[model samples]
Target: MNRRTIQGKYEIFLQKYNEGVKKYIPIYRVKKSIHTWYNAR
Candidate 1:
């Protein structure tokens, strides 16, 4: 039971970790596009 609880918490932490990565990835992608946009203009 203790191990299961730890696993559950770890899973939750991984979910948050993935969510953070997902959120940051799009922002970073947009930032990268800013340079190209100015060049194109």
Candidate 2:
């Protein structure tokens, strides 16, 4: 795929992932230091 297409897809994927995370987990409860296992798909 082209760079632009890959970038657009990545943004969409990230937005959806963020929304999913917010839906399941409270924003204030998310600790970056404690949750180092989370990785970008």
Candidate 3:
């Protein structure tokens, strides 16, 4: 039972972390692309 609960918590943490990364990745990519374009100009 204790191990199950710990595993559940770890799973939840990973889900949240993955969601956060997913949300930020697009923003990061957009910013990077814009920076590169402006620098090239």
Full-model lDDT for every candidate:
0.75, 0.79, 0.76
Which candidate should be chosen as best, given TM-score against the real structure? 2
Can you tell me which runs of candidate 2 are displaced by over 4 Å? 1-4, 27-41
TM-score of each: 0.50, 0.51, 0.50
Q: RMSD (Cα, Å) of candidate 2?
A: 14.0
Error of model 2, residue 6, in angstroms = 0.1
lDDT of 2: 0.79
lDDT of 2 by residue, 1-41 (tens): 36668789899889999999989986565555746577664
Cα lDDT tens digits for candidate 3, 1-41: 36678889899889999999988877533443455546645
State residue 2's C-alpha deviation in candidate 2, in Å. 11
Worst 10 residues of 2 by lDDT: 27-36
Q: Write the per-residue lDDT of candidate 1 for residues 1-41, one digit (tens) a residue.
A: 36668889899889999999988876533444456547645
Report the candidate with higher TM-score, 2 versus 3. 2
- The residue pairs that clash in candidate 3, if any, are none
Model 3 misplacement above 4 A: 1-4, 27-41
TM-score-based ranking, best first? 2, 3, 1
Question: Which of 2 and 3 is ahead in lDDT?
Answer: 2
